[model samples]
Target chain A: MAHDTIIAALKAKFAELVTTEFRDNFRVVVAPARLFDVLQSLKDEHGFNMLFELTAADYLKYPKATDRFGVVYGLLNMATGVRIFVKTWLNEPDLTLPSAFPLWKGADWLEREVYDMYGILFDGHPDLRRILMPEAFTSFPLRKDYPLRGRGERHNFAVITRAES
Target chain B: MPLEALPTLPEGPEKDYLWTLNFGPQHPATHTTLRLILTLDGETVVTAVPDIGFLHSGFEKLGEDLDFNQYVTIVDRMNYISPIMNEIAWHHTVEKLMGIELTPRCKYIRTILGELARISDHLLCAGAQALDLGAFTAFLYGFQQREVIYDIYETISGQRFHPSYTRVGGLLFDVTDQFIRKVRNFVKEFPKTHADMCRLLNRNRIFLERTQGIGVLSKELAIDLSCTGPLARSSGVVRDLRKDEPYLAYPDFQTAFKVVCAAEGDCYARYIVRMEEMIESLKIIDAAIENLPAGAVNVDVESKAVFPAQTSVYRSIESMIQHFELVMPNRQWTPPVDEVYGAIESPNGELGFYIVSDGTGVAYRARTRPPSYIHFAVFPYLIEGHQISDVVAVLGSLNIIAAELDR
Candidate 1:
């Protein structure tokens, strides 16, 4: 069945928001500039209260990729059990986008994870530092270009001998 | 009142006395591998900063390198307490991506195992919660039953810990009648131990003192923070993916079970919710075993996503060729070049897998929405204004599996 209510609400409320074909759930693609506004609207008006998941997909090597990274925001309306994906594409070099932390408090760690893995920077994130990776590590491991077997940086750490301490 | 609303120490000479205490990447109460920097004013916590990623094995990055089948082994370590749930969640998403339907027997068998995994996980959480609260006997009561569930898993998959039995289309092997008989016996006898645990802890004054009104999370905060499964249910969020989304064979056992909840949202309430959930899981397992269908467990032979039987390979050339192609790299099925997000109601919460496919056996990007990763964030909010001792209570209540965080 076509999810006309949500589409109508989005079109009626925010005419500029671009929504794509409904697949597994309602999929919306909005510009990076309008992300904060759209997310706020979804949270306040549409009752998509929970930003349950936030992750970026590195589509650099994929033939069908339109952008270098696709940051997927998995939204859910708690009462209704409705889910939607709000996606914003970011190209290489300047991997900057508006952070959803201000909208949903749960987005704090998620945005940090996206930044840690994909090297995507979130603007206005309070503490957007490395979450899963070390703060000193330079390269983003989840990026398509990054090697699976990391570049032997661990070998540099001095091995602790019995007498070293 | 929720713990966060309590008065913070206003600025003055008193601010200098605020003790900065490091609570475990190795400490006992933390259950290891999760560190929390607690700013304390005497016994009451002022602000808590979480530092995780100690067990960071790079599982998600491994997903891209490992094809669909190889990835199951990685998911096992993510939520190591209940690996079968991870396996089911992984294959469930993969099947959704591949548009493969499981047979009736496969569905029923998965439902039984999934509920068993839920019970097994809840038992650990309950045991750990009691163990952390100084109730050693209660811990043993719940923990000993977990071994029986492990025995059940071993009967099916030949492994006690990380079964990794689930495959993309069906399973590693079809469960025998012996497996069904074992499951039947488990559900029958599990409740006696369940009652013993409930009688020991539910009314015990010390257990109530340690847990009740401690680590309180409000219903609004619970929903806003996207907490699910027992954590949200304990806070009166009343949202369970099993009831609402109804993936697997949960809908079939609708009359037999329910979404357990509690209004308290404290450590005690979380424990109670878990305790009640185990019973509900037993009800699901019992109902499923009773009405278990008799048929081939795997999908039709035409489906390429599943591993073929060895005898079938010996009997037919097509089976041998299919097995060879599936085992070999870059010679197997090609799923659609699309993205799909699918989640199951794991023992903790909404354990989800988001797979972005490039129309290859290997996923372009495989991300997991681990419940622990998000639930751990709520800790700083919950533990503030509560005593340092309540930290363990809160952490145990949330069941923050540290292995899930790094992924």
Candidate 2:
């Protein structure tokens, strides 16, 4: 299968950096430190040309969890139309992961969004500012600890009037 | 927060001539609520930083609280221009997560409706682009045809805007003969308006001058920024999910129509690509209608995935129990504990849902990868060297709806 070849290639190249498995397609688990290297290899060597999606998931109460947060990287090989997910977990005190901006320019906003939602820091990102939320906002809304209704953040905004303008 | 946070222009010899100009969150050029902090030297835009989230409603958070079927309503607001496509995309993901294969009739009906959504979406994009460029007549022509498409939607779903028609394994109801006739009439009549709009703008001297080379996005940059749909196709990235990864009944009509692409990678290229796509959509709709099979619109009510019919629920205890089990919050259907990312070729681009289920009716995490969000991010790069007046032309061509962009 196509996944088998990808797994074999990843295993042969970055055996120490990542652990590969099959879920949906091929899924690779990389340590936070080795994430960039693994992603670079996948893009440069394996022809994973497109970064389909880059998102983060909070696993605070997950049954199977080694870390509190997981950063998922969805990569696509446009020629073969095969997709693989590369994920890395961030522990309690250190919630930072390497940025994939160098590999794919698409990572600029995707990483910024992850930083916005989960408070997960992306080291070496050019602009790691809040994208969806306002600049003054402090809370990370997507984290498990964050409340759904929000902690009075919505009510804090001062509505401007025509007189003020 | 004060305006103190605004970054001042770098002090240099040229800094005296450069000034910051604000474009929308209110202006018509943006098409929707979007703010752009544009730095311009005279009329040339030095940089354009898109400020979004004016319409962010946190749909992803709502997705976590709602069940698979219940969340369909939330996605309906994601892309308000063509709400049915969002509903279909959301349910398509849920069905895939639960490993539910739709009936042949359901698949065929979904394909037809999905193509219709694409036509309406492209029509609005093309019409709005022309409208922004002062071609008001072409916009009127395109919108008139869009109204007919909406009429067909109203006939089938009853609600024109937010038609929550697609269910997990099937459609809400079977199409009536009248609905089929209206759609047939729409496909037959839509081409005239489509052709008229093409003639009005495609070769017009003024339209060509304004759009031909404005906002040119290279194929590499398009892929680097993860652009899709017409935006990517116009830039020579030949990736179409319908052709590459066929879902529903798309594979059935692979040769009926070809994917439209242009190598120019400009606003005109995008406009032409969208215009050509409407024709392809009409072709797909015609094929689907001709080969429409006779069967049940939905799967068996006994399957528990869908609610039981009112007649059955009133007459039998078994059906009544099934309805209560489905409608009750505590006893709703539970998907297996797993994570899956399902994507579809939305009119905008690749609209994908990344779902994490915890073996409950509700989701652990539901993330929507909106195409507009990614496409809008590349705005600063695309408009960097262009004239300020050309901004609206490019913005209209991108067709970034604020609800989808910020959501």
* DockQ, cand. 2: 0.57
| lDDT for each residue of candidate 1 in A1-165, tens digit (9 for 90 to 100) | 335687778778677777774246578888787888888888888889988989888888988567888888989987677888888888867789988877888989988888888889999998878877776788988888889989997676977898987
Model 2 TM-score relative to the real fold = 0.96
State each model's CA lDDT, in order. Answer: 0.86, 0.86
* Candidate 2: stretches off by over 4 Å: A16-23, A64-66, A157-165, B1-10
Q: Which candidate has the top score in DockQ?
A: 2
DockQ for all candidate structures vs. native: 0.56, 0.57
lDDT of 2 at B97: 82
Q: Interface root-mean-square deviation for each candidate?
A: 5.7, 2.2
DockQ measured for candidate 1: 0.56
- The single-chain TM-score for chain B of candidate 1 is 0.96
In model 1, pairs of residues that clash are: none
Docking class of 2: medium
TM-scores for all candidates?
0.96, 0.96
